[model samples]
Target: MRLLIVDDQPLVRQGLRAVFAGLDDIIVAGEAAHGAEALELVRRTAPHVVLMDVNMPVMGGLEATRRICAAGRADPDRTLPKIVMLTMYDQDEHVFEALRAGASGFLIKDASPQQLADAVREVVDDGAMLSPSITRRLIREFVRRPALPAPDGELSALTGRERDVFRLLVQGYGNAGIAEKLTLGESTVKSHVQSLYRKLGVQDRVQVVIYAYENGLI
Candidate 1:
């Protein structure tokens, strides 16, 4: 896959390039120092995926992702490149904002070279990735936070089965995983996922998960 690297630090981009240099399936298409340059690179190279740093001197990764995704959504036939954000902030309060901006994954800046490579591959494969530490912190924060009543009667709108599906989904189960856990067919799980989306007024799993957490639904 053709990959573009976006980070303010040249050394960080160099290290990522070195990590991909030895890999067969992954190739470094280009590098950029900020989100604006990254957008220009994407226009020229049309890379399959982008490794983005959350904070930068000029435009930030989150804003870039939002613009890229918005443009793609405007064209029905276009398939925009996937984005995986890299950051040093462990608290990562911007994670949800990044998701709202269309990021597919999030990674720690300090991840090992191999972990970085694996993240690139995972996002290329159309999967979501989150650093283990950030994942734990996010889950704990939502689970232990003071319970807030679900807004706009959204929680009450779900059927019992849909609620069951939502519960497991927020727990990080994929469609097939949730299917097996619920003893339902994979297609059934997908249908339930769609139903959850419609009822809860969400676009994707990330939004659903956040909604469930913020509203104390899970």
Candidate 2:
């Protein structure tokens, strides 16, 4: 996997590069000092994943993310690199904004090298990286907001089995875990998940989680 490291701090960029250097499967595509540089490198290197710091001069990670995501959406041929935001602050506002800006994952800046490597791999495998702490904070942040009524018959298209799968998924169950709980095969659970994604117009499990929260289904 090709990885891009983006940060204003040279030390941070160097450190991240070094971490990926040890992993034979991961290649350090490039490094950028700020968001603008990151954008240029992204177009040049076409990395599969980007490790981006939130705050920077010229352009911030959030804005760059928005632009990159938009460009990817507009051009069907260009592969959109998954962006994993690196931030010091674990504030709810920051987390929410990153999601809104199209970040595939969020990671604390202080994360260990292994955790960082794992996060990149997970996002590449159609997964998202939200640490347990971040997940809890996100839940609490949404819980404090005024509840939104789910659209009428929003779930009517889903079958009873699909609903069961969605419920477990929103509660943080993976396909294997959901299968175990539902007494079904892993492949069957995967089918239900894909069906849920199709009916809900969501791209991945992370989007499904956000959808459930936005519609107050959680």
Candidate 3:
């Protein structure tokens, strides 16, 4: 997978580059010192993933992500690169805003290289990633919030069985686990997953969880 690294510190970039060196399938496509440069490199290289530092000169990763999604909307046929925010800030506000701004994943800067790489791969293949702690926090936050408005037209698309599958999904169950719990075949579980994704306009399990939490379905 082609990756663009965006961080202001040379050492941090070097460290990431070293970590990815042994992986045959992973390649460092470009580097950027700040958000503006990152956007330029994104346009030029069209990497599959972008590892972005949250804080930077002139612009921040959040804004860069917003702009990137805006551009993608303007050119709907082109696939937008997955954006993973790599930052020191793990505050609730920061996390909320970054996700709202179109980041597919968020990770702390202190994450191990393996974790970072895994996050990138998750976002690329599954459309979202969140560190364990981040996921916990998100769930807690959603639980604390007031009741969400009932999904008006959208919830009607899901069948009764799909809704049951979705409830397990938001609780972080994988296909095998879900199948076992529901007493269904794994292939049947996979079909339900695909159907849910189509109905909900979600690309992956992570987004399904997020949507469930945000909509107060879990």
Candidate 4:
């Protein structure tokens, strides 16, 4: 997996680069001190995933994420890069906004090297890296809010099995977990997941969670 590290601190960037150095499968594509440099590197290197710091000088990670995602949308031929925000707190206010800005997931700034590596792989594999604590916090926050009106017949478009898969996915179950829970094969669960993605017009698991929360389906 190719990765670009975006942070304002030199030590943080160096530390992350060292972590990935031990992994044979992952390559550190480049490093940037801020969001503007990140954008320039992104265009030049075309990394598969970007490890973005939430707060930075010149341009913030949120704005950079918005721009990167927007660029992908503007050019269908360009593959969208998955962004995982590095944050100071799981309950940080910017976490949700990062998701809204098109970030794939988040990791606490003090996450261990193993956790960092795992998060990178997860996001690249089309999974969201929301830990249990983060998931619970998201649920709690959404519970206090009023639900947005879902588009006409959006939920109805899903079949019974697809709905089951959707619920499990929003609950943070991966394909293998969903298969075990529903007593189906792993490949079958993946098929249902892709089907759900297609019907819901979502690109990844993070978007699925956002959709469920926004429509009051969770």
Candidate 5:
């Protein structure tokens, strides 16, 4: 997969490039020090995924992502490259705004190199990726909100088992942990996760957690 790296720090870019160096399936197509440069690079490289930093001079990643999505929408035949916000901030507002601006996921800088690679691969494969802390924040926010009318499309879509899986998921349980908790085999839990993903139109666990929060399911 062709990849673009967008960060204000040269060291961050270098570290990310070095991380991708070990992955044969990924290629670093371009690098940018700021959002404006990122926009230009996206236009030129047409990368499959962008690892974007949220804070930067001239333009922020959020606005850049918005613009990129807007441009892609203007050209219907072209699919926009997946945008992942890699940042130090895990605040509720930041995550929410980034998602609103079309970020496929958000991760912190402290994530291991393998985690970074996994996040890239997830987005490239049309999936979502959010750090564990972000997932927790989303769940807490969702649970704290006043109950609203649940959408029939979202509510009726989930089966009883799927709802159980989703509840544990929002609480930050992995498939194995969930399986153990539910007294089911790992493969059975995996099947339920896949079904939940399809029913919710979500690509990854993070989005599933976010959906639970947004819909007040957890």
Candidate 6:
């Protein structure tokens, strides 16, 4: 997997590059000090995924993500590069907005080298990835929210089986896990996932969960 590291700090960028250096399946394609430079490098390097810092000078990751994803949506034939926001602890509160801004997922800034490599591969293979703590935290937050009227149009749009799939999916199960739980084939699970995205007009599993929570479907 080719990667573009975007951060304002030189040492942080160096640390990330060094982590990938020993990995046989990973390559550090380029580096940028901030989101603006990352945007330019993204077009030139065409890295499969970008590890973008949430905060940077010139342009932050959120704005860069919006612009990049907006352009990608305009041309369906071209694949937009996946972005995973690299966030610090204080930035956890901004993760939801980052997803809305078009990040595929995010990781904590203090992630270990192996965790970093795994996150890159996970997003590429699964379409999204969240740190375990983030997953638990999101679920807890969703559970604690007071009930709201479910979005009938969105909820009713789903078939019974699709709702079954969505239930497990929002609980943080991936394709394999969902398939096993439903006793369905992996391709069948993938089809349901695609259907969920299409019907809900959501980009990733994270948004699916958010939708479920906000709509009181969780």
Best by lDDT: 4
Residue-wise lDDT of candidate 4 within 90-202, one digit each (tens)? 76478788888888888888888999999999999888887667777887888998988876587899999999999899888988899999999998988998788768877
Model 4: lDDT of residue 200: 85
Cα lDDT listed for each candidate: 0.82, 0.87, 0.83, 0.88, 0.83, 0.84
Name model 5 segments beyond 4 Å from true.
150-218
| Residue-level error in angstroms, candidate 2, position 102 | 2.0
Which tens-of-lDDT digit does each residue in 13-64 have in candidate 5? 9999999997999999999998999999999999999999999999989899
Off by over 4 Å in 1: 144-167, 182-204
Error of 5 at 48 (Å): 1.0
- Per model, state how many residue pairs clash: 0, 0, 0, 0, 0, 0
Q: Tens digit of lDDT per residue, candidate 2, span 29-132?
A: 99998889988999999999999889999999998988888788677578889899999878777789888777879999889999999999998876899877
Model 5 — which ten-residue stretch has the worst lDDT?
Answer: 201-210
Candidates' TM-scores?
0.76, 0.84, 0.81, 0.87, 0.72, 0.87
Per-residue lDDT of model 1, residues 92-162, tens digit only: 57776787687877888888888888877776654577888877877776767887787867777888888
Residue 175's lDDT within candidate 4 is: 89
By summed lDDT, the worst window of 10 consecutive residues in model 6 runs over: 89-98
Q: Rank the candidates by lDDT, best first.
A: 4, 2, 6, 5, 3, 1
Per-residue lDDT value at 156 in model 2: 91
Q: How far off is model 1, as Cα RMSD? A: 3.5
lDDT of 3: 0.83
The alpha-carbon deviation from the true structure for residue 212 of candidate 3, after best TM-score superposition, in angstroms, is 1.6
List all candidate RMSDs to the true structure.
Answer: 3.5, 2.6, 3.0, 2.3, 4.8, 2.3
Candidate number that wins on lDDT, 4 or 5: 4
